[model samples]
Target: MINAFGALRPDQPIHVFTKASRWLLDRTITVPVTIVEQAVDSGAIQRDSLQLDVPATLASAAQFEAGADEAAVALAREFRARHVQVAVCDAPPMPCTAAHLAGVPAVVLANFTWDWIFEDFIAEHPAFAELPARLGVRYARADAAWRLPMHGGFGTVRTVLDFPWIARRSRRGRAELRRLIGAGDARPLVLISFGGYGVANMALAHHAGAPYRLVLSGGAEHSPTDAPPDALHLDRERLDALGLRYEDLVAAVDVVASKPGYGIVSECVANGAALLYTDRGRFREYPVMVDEMPQVLPCRHIANASLASDRWDEEVAGLLAQPRPEIRPLVNGADVAAGMISAML
Candidate 1:
C-alpha cells in the first residue's frame, strides 16, 4: 500500500503508525511494533510513535476495547497535528475511527478485520462477546474498504486487486542458496516462519527425522532447547544485515512452512514456492487462507500436536513429491488502493 501510494504521488507524505505497548496476548502479536520499528529503521516508511497507542497484552476484552478507543483519540490528535489527509489502515477500526474523528477519509485495506477475529473467541471468552458489535460500529465508519481474496468475511468493502507481495521476486537459484545455507542438494530446504513471534510448543527437531533441512526463522524465542543441531535459526537482524527479506529466503527455498497468515501465504504463492502450513489455533483468517492458498500453490497442513512429534515426516515427503505448480501472479491491489486514495486526495 505504501509503495503504491508513493508511486502515484511521490511528494505525498506517508507515515506508518503501529501499536506499541507491552502485551502478552499472543506471542505472535508480541513483536509487531518491533517489526514496524525495523521497517521504519530500514527507511521503508516514516514513523510517528505518537500515533501508535495500544494497551499492554493480557488486557481483558473490555479493557482492550477501552484501550483501542483511547488510542483512537490519540491517533486523531496526531492526525490533526500532522495534517494527515487520508488514513490508510490495515489494522482494526481504531485507526479508522481516528480518521473519522479527524474528518478525514479512512481507507481500510486488508484481508481480515478485528470483528471476525473476536467472533471466534466470543463464545469461550465472554469478555469478547460484545466486542464484535463494538468493532462493527467502528468499522462502519470507514469511507472505503478494499478487500483481498480468502478474507475473514467481516468487511463488506469492495474487493480490490490481490494484495501486493513484498518479497524479492528474484532469488538465487536453488543450488546456490542451498550451498550458501549449508544444506546438501539431495534434500530440499524448507523455510519455517510463523511470522515475527514464533509458535509455541513447536519442536523443529521433529522435522529432523525427515529428509529435508529445516530452517527456522525467528524460532529461537519459542523453540525447545533440545532443537536439533542441524536445524538453522535466522533472526530478523541477521536477515536485514544480509539485505535479504524473509521472502527472498522463501523464494530460494523449496518449501515454505508457516502459519496461514495473509502476508506469508500471499508471498509464498507469488514467489512460486510450495506451502507446508499448520494451524494458528482458531484464528479466523486461517480457515479462509487454508482454503484459498491451496488453489494456487501446492499446500499441505500439519496438526498442532503433531508439530512436536515425527508426524511431519510423511507430510513433508508428500509435499515434496508433488509437482511444483505454475504460479500466475495476480494484479497488485496496491495500485487499486492508490488510485482510490488519489481520488479522495
Candidate 2:
C-alpha cells in the first residue's frame, strides 16, 4: 500500500486522467494506473498493482454494460474472494451491493445512480458509508482509521479541464456543422454525446428521427461503425498528445446532445457550443462541475427523452438564440484530494 492507490474511471476521458494522475504521481506516489478496455490496475496496494474492481467488472463487459448482475452467486463468491480489499470502484446498485455482501474491506464508488439507490443500504450497513455522491478515492487503513464522507486529498481539482492534453480536432470536425433540428427539416444543427461512448449512443437514439443532423465524437475506445447514416462521427486520436491542442467541433454545431462529463462541460463551454444534455444517473457534476460562470449559460439537460415535443424544441431554440456567457475553468478536486491524502498518511 506504499506505492499508490487507484479506483480508475473505466469509461472516462483518458487524456484528462493521464494528466490528473500525473500531478499526484510526480509529487507523491510513483506507481501509475494501468487501464485496458475495461480492466484497470492501480498502483501497488495489497499486492503489486492490486486490482480494485468489484466482482462484476471481472465478469466481462457484455453481461453488465449498464451495471453488474447479482443473480450469479458463484461468480459473486469467486469475485469477492479475489477482489476483497481496501479499494475504490464505481459500483452501481447491484454490483456494489454484491461487493459489500462479499466482504470487501473498503469500497469507494465514483458515480451516482447506484449510489442513491444503495445509499441507505451502504449507510445502514456500516460498510458502505463512504459513497455519498463523493468523488476522489475513499478507503480506510487495514484497521479502519479513515472513514466515509471524505471529499479529496493532495490538490483539489473541480473541473477536469484544467489538465490539458494534445488531442486534436478532426478535419471533419473542423467543417461548419449544420444539422436539421426542430419541427421541420430546416432547423439548425444539434449534436449529442457523453464524454463516454455509451452516452453517445443514448444521444443518437434519443434524436433518431429529429429533423436535426447530429455529430458524435468518438474515441479509440469507441467509433462510428454502427452509427446512424445521419450522424457524423469524429476521431479523437489527437487527445493523447501532450500540448492539449484540440479542436472545437462542438462550437460549430448549433446544439450539443450529450452527457456533461466535468471535462466535457468545460471543453464545450470553451468552444461555445450550445448544450442539450441527457443526464446520466450518477454523474450529476457533469453539468455543474465548472466554476466558470459562463459555463452554465450554454449548458442544459432535459428532464426526460422526448425530442419531438414542441416545448423541447422551443427550449433548445431559445437557448441557441441567447447570448453566451464567458468564464474561466475551475480547479480544486486534486487539491482537496491531496489534503485528504496528507491526513491519511
Q: Which prediction has the highest TM-score against the true structure?
A: 1
Off by over 4 Å in 1: 20-61, 67-70, 155-176, 199-201, 205-209, 222-224, 323-331
Alpha carbon lDDT at 276, candidate 2: 70
Q: Which regions of candidate 2 fall more than 4 Å away from where they truly are?
A: 1-121, 130-187, 199-211, 218-230, 235-246, 283-295, 307-312, 326-345
After aligning candidate 1 to the native by TM-score, how far in Å is the CA of 10 from where it should be?
A: 2.9
Q: Could you give candidate 2's per-residue lDDT for residues 30-111 as a string of tens digits? A: 3443422222222111111111233222222223322333432443474455543333333222333344455553233232
Error of 1 at 124 (Å): 2.9
Worst-scoring 10-residue span by lDDT in model 2: 43-52
lDDT of each: 0.62, 0.38
Give the clashing residue pairs of candidate 1, or none: 23-57, 24-57
CA lDDT for candidate 2:
0.38
TM-scores of the candidates in the order shown: 0.78, 0.42
- How well does candidate 2 match the true structure in TM-score terms? 0.42
